[model samples]
Target: MNPRVIGTVRSHLVSRDQCPKYGDTSMPPVWIELAPDFEPAATDLQVGDAILVLTWMHKGDQAVLRCHPQGNRKLPMRGIFSTRSPDRPTPIGLHAVRILGREGLRLKVHPLEVIDGTPVIDIKPDNATLQGTAEFSSLVNPDTGQAILSAARDGWLRGLFAGFNGNVSMRQGERVVITATGSAKGHLGPRDLAVVDLATGTPLTSVRASSELAVHLEVYRNQPLARAIVHTHPPKLLALSLRGEGPLLDLPLFEGRVFADKLTRVPAHRPGTPELGQAVGVASRDFEAVFMDNHGLVCRGETMTQALGLSEELESLAGIAMRR
Candidate 1:
C-alpha cells in the first residue's frame, strides 16, 4: 500500500548534495505545508514542541543497496540498513526538529536538512531517545521551565543578549532549572535546558549547566525571597558602562528612580568565577538588580516575569541615559 502525502517541505536545499549528513541547529528554517485535509492532524502541535518528521525522499536512488557512510569515498561500504544513506530501498527520511511556529496550514521548523518539495508522510512527537542527551528531572516543574524558556526568548528578541552571551534560571526548592551553555536563547529546544542542584550546582541531568551557574547559586544563597533570575548583556547598559557611567540607577526621571530604587552597582570581577558570583550575590541581597562594571546586568525577582521586567526597565533607563 502507498502512503499518502500529507505535506511537502519548503526548504532552500534543492538537491541531495546540498543537504548535510545530519540535521543540526545550524541548518536553516524549513516549512512543512500540510494539505487542507491534513491540517486537522497538526492541531495538537505547538511551538517549542519536539517532533519527528517522516519524509519520502523522492530524489533518492531506490536501486542502491549499499554505499559509503555519508558519501565519504574512503569509508568502508555499508549496507543500506546499517547507514543513514538516503539511497535506501524505502528512502524514508526521519528528521528530529523543533517547531518554531505555526501559521495556518504551514508549520515552520528548524534544523531540517531535507530537500525542498520532499513529501512528508507523517509527523509524531519526539520520543525519549530523541531527547536522551538532556534528561529532565521529575522534581522540576515543567510550567516553570517553559516560563524560563519564554523569558529567554523575550530577552533575545528584545536585543538583551548578543549571540549566546546570556543565561536564565529559576529556583525550584533545592533545584534550579537553567539554560544550557551555548544554547541559543531565542531558538531553545527541549535539550537546550537542564536542572541542577541549587546548593552544590551539580547538574541533575546529563546536560551540563550554564557556565554562570555559580552566580545563580550564590544569588539564591543570599536572597531567600528570589525565585527567578535573569542575566543579560543589554546593549545600552553595556555602552553606558563602557563610557564609565557611575551608577545605572542615576536616571533623570523620577519614575525611573522609583522603578529602580533597589538597583545597585557591583565592582568588576572575572565572569563565571566565584568572586564575581559572590559580588553579585551579596549585592542582590538588598537590591533587585545589579550593574557590574565592565560586564552586564543581573536581576532577581519573586518570579521570572518580575525578573525579566526589571531587566527590561534598566535597559530602557540606560537608553534614556545614553540620549542625554
Candidate 2:
C-alpha cells in the first residue's frame, strides 16, 4: 500500500550517519515543504509549536530486520523493533520538532535529523500525551499560573529551554502547579499551568499536565525535601551526559568539584514512558539532581525559586567542570 506523501523534508543533513542518534539543540533548522494540496493543514500550526513529524526514510534498508544499535559492531545485534533503527520493514521516521516559522506551505522546525528529500507522511500537534489527561481538571489557578510563567520566562532567557522543551512544577501544599504539556515554556501563564494532586498525579486544572508528570509526582511522594521541581534542557549538562562525564563530574575547579553533588545518570528510556518516569522517580529518591542520559536534567528544590536556581547552578557547574 502506498502512503500519499503530504510533504518533504528539506534539511542540510544528507544521510542518517550525519545525524545524531537523538535530535537536540545542536541540529540545524529544517524545513517541511508541504505540497500545495496539503497547505490547508498548515493553518493550525504556528511558530513555537511542537509537532510530531512522521516521515518515510527512503534511504534506509527495509530488508535488514536486525543489526547493531547505531551501527556499532561491538554492541550485540538486536531486532530492529527494539531499537529506533530506521532500517526496518517500514522505514518511517518520527521526529518531535519545534516550529520555528511558518509560511504558506512551508514550516521551519528545529531538531529534525532526517535527511533532505525525505517524504513526510503527516504532521500533528503534540500538545500533551493523552495517557494521563483523564484525571485532570480543565480549570487553572491564576496565581500559580502567573508564578510559573515568570519562572518559564527566566528559563527561556537563560537558554535552558529550546522553545517549549522543558517543564517546571511548584508544589503548594498537597497540590502542584505544573507547566501544561505542549505550552510554550517561554510564554507560560496561569492558563498554561495545570494544578495537580501530588498523590495521584491527577490534574486539577483544565490543561493537561506535562508529559513528565509521573516523575514529578514520584519526587513529591519520595522526597519530602522536594517542594518544587525544574526540568530543563541545559546544553552543557546534556553535553556532559553525552561525553560520559555526567555521573561523576569531578572537575578541577574548586566550586565545580566540591559544591556539586554527584549527578545520577538514569539510563536511556523512551521519554514520557511509564518506565522512564519510574526510573526518574526512583532516582530522585536518592539524588537531588538527576541527569537523564542523552536527554535533559531533573532538579528539585524546597521552593519554586530554589528549583529554578538549581537548574542554573547545574548548568554553571557543568560548564565549569567541562572547561577544566
Candidate 3:
C-alpha cells in the first residue's frame, strides 16, 4: 500500500531568514494525524530505519525563484537547482527523518530542515541499499535472526551512518574498532564502551567508547530495521534530558504535531550492564530518540545518516525548549 501524508508542516518562525538554510534544521514540533488504517512496524525502530518524510515548504516562495537562479546569500546569482534553496521551482521538500517515537498519530522526527508549519506531503519507508564502501561488522547472536553476523560481514547491514559528522566505532566478537577519525573520537572514549554476545550475555569486548552505546546495542537488538545508531551529548539535548520533564507537547514557536507519535523518553540506565541494554531496547521499540534521564540522548535509524539526523534534531528541539 502507498504511504499516506498524515500531517501538515507549519513553521514556528515565519520569517524567511529564520527558516533553515541547510537541510539540517531542528524542526519545531508539528502534529501528524495518522491514517485510520496505518500502523508502524513492530520490533520498534532502531537507530537507522529509512523514512521518507514528506514536508510542505510553507515558507517557500516559489515566485521568488524567478529573480535569483540560486538562493546563495553570498553569491551574486545561481539557479535554484544549482543551490540547496527551499525556494525551488517546486516548493515540495522530502526529508528522510529517523523515527524518534510514536504516540498515537504524533510522531517525533529528527533533522527536518523545513520551516515550521510546513505541510507534510507524505511519509514513506526508504529501502535504499547501502553503498559498497561502507564499514560494517558482525554481531553475534542478533535477537532476530541467526545470520545477523553474516549479514554484517557481507555488508548487508544498511549504510545507516552515512554522511554523519561524528566519531563512531563497531564491535565484533571481542574487538572494538573505531570507524571514524578526529572529532568523532573526542566525543567517545574506550572506558565508555562494552560488547557482549547478544544471546548469552557473555562479555565479548568492552571499551570506553561512549556511555551511549548501551542505547545503540539495545535498538540493534529490538528494532529489526535499525542498522546503525548514534548517540550525542549535545548541550541542548543534554539539558532537556536533564530536566527530567514530560514529553514535548505544544510548539510554542512552531507546530508540535510534525513529530507526533515519534518521540520517547527513557529513564537513565545503569551503565555497562545487560539491564541498560534491555532498557534501551525496550525504549527503542517504536521511537528514534530516547531521552536518557540525566545521561544523554540516543537515536536510531536504518542508516547512520538517519541516526545522526535524529540526534541533531533532538539537539535542536532541546535548544528550542531551553530558549523557551
Model 2 has an lDDT value of 0.77
TM-score of 2: 0.54
Q: Order of all candidates by TM-score, from best down to worst?
A: 1, 2, 3
Q: Listing every candidate in turn, what is its Cα RMSD in Å to the true structure after a full C-alpha superposition?
A: 12.7, 19.3, 19.4
Question: Which scores greater on lDDT, model 2 or model 3?
Answer: 2
What are the per-residue Cα lDDT tens digits for candidate 2 across 156-258?
Answer: 8998998878898877657777888898988764456676777777765467889888778877887889877889989987777677643546666666654
TM-score of each: 0.59, 0.54, 0.40
lDDT of 1 by residue, 20-50 (tens): 9987678779999999998778775666556
Clashes of each: 0, 5, 64
Q: Candidate 1: which stretches are off by over 4 Å?
A: 1-139
Tens-digit lDDT track for model 3 on 95-202? 756555456655666666555556665666553312222312122112212222222222212332222222343333222232222223322222223344444434
